[model samples]
Target chain A: MIWQFDLFILVLLVITALVALKVRDLLSAAMIFSIYSLLMCLLWAEMGAVDVAFTEAAVGAGLSTVFLIATILRTTRRTTD
Target chain B: MSDVLTFIISRFNYWIYIVLMMIGLYAMIAKRNYVKKFIGMSIFQTAIILFYVSTGVKSGATIPILEHGHDIGHAAAAINPDHYANPLPHVLMLTAIVVGVATLGVALAVVQKVHDQYETIEEPEILFKLGQE
Candidate 1:
């Protein structure tokens, strides 16, 4: 894998991870976490793990995001702490 | 200076994964909301998957599929394993990705039920309610 591209994706992954955890809005955090998953999918694809990337894109970015948003809507949108 | 740069560049993926794992752990431990904890758990699982997949990478290698394996005669030729990326971690991670999502969905469903029971998803509130009852 190209270290330059790897570094770029990794940096964004970290940023999105932190934001996902720190965000007060649960829906926003879920969306940011989906972005994190997409970045991870890109990194895996770059490293030639195509099947793994495809699974991540479909499961991590797609289904999990839908599940999280559904849960947030059914429950609460804001976090207490 | 070049040695330091090379060292850092060569192993940066591992270091970054470790950092991501720690972030996930912190979220799991410190967050008050159940959904936040669930998110942290997903982050932690993804970081571990990243590390495993990175370990399977080889320089100048193609995907794991054998180019000429479909041909009977070509299959007899000695193929160098170094030409292809490792498939083990990718396969393992595919299972892990599915398991992670399954757990996430279950955990969130439980969290919703908890919200229904306690009228809140906060750990402290739930605990306090439980203590009173």
Candidate 2:
């Protein structure tokens, strides 16, 4: 019953998440994190949890990333880790 | 062989979720930047939400919304609960999502204030500054 499309989405999700965590530039990390969030939204939608997907798209892709980038704007963008 | 394939396919989503959870856990525990830890915490929350939502899904069930034409006059007329996904988890997670946003907002504000005072967002540097004062 596993859909090929869902499997593809999961692979991309994992890759984006890892890159988001590993990237040096805070801006790049924030952008990649949005990608991760959107993929998660899609997954939840496919799973019949439309409410969760909608919330994730709004909070994760929209508000959370914007706030993270705003914080970066206020502070330095470089990270030692 | 097909039996094993079916079993793995049926259960692989949970496995993937577990791997994602571990990644977030490791990042939260080992990342040096305060923002990174915040990201990890959010990821961890997402994983838990996903797990709970998946639990409410019944195989072959549709979305929880009731059909418009269905009547409630009798036991047979009622919309069978098993025909739709369970909605309790979805309702609870609604509150969780709002709380998560508030948490992220508060966490980022704390990070901003710490950066303003110490001029650094790295944990080690913040600790160093705190130790000096």
Q: Which candidate tops DockQ?
A: 1
- In candidate 1 chain B, where is summed lDDT lowest over 10 consecutive residues? B69-78
> TM-score of every model?
0.94, 0.90
Model 1 spans > 4 angstroms off: B1-9, B75-78
DockQ of each: 0.86, 0.69
Expressed as tens digits, the lDDT of each residue in B1-133 for candidate 2 is: 9999899878877888887888899899999999899888888888888888878888788877877655555645666887888888988887888898899999999999998889999999888888999
Q: How does chain B of model 2 score on TM-score?
A: 0.86
DockQ of 1: 0.86
> Candidate 2 on A7-53: residue-level lDDT in tens?
78878887887898999999999999999999989988887789988
Residue-wise lDDT of candidate 1 within B1-133, one digit each (tens)? 9999999877888899999999999999999999999999999999999999988999999888888787868574778889999999899989999999999999999988988999999999999999999
Expressed as tens digits, the lDDT of each residue in A41-75 for candidate 1 is: 99999999999999999999999999999999998
Question: For each candidate, what is the lDDT?
Answer: 0.92, 0.86
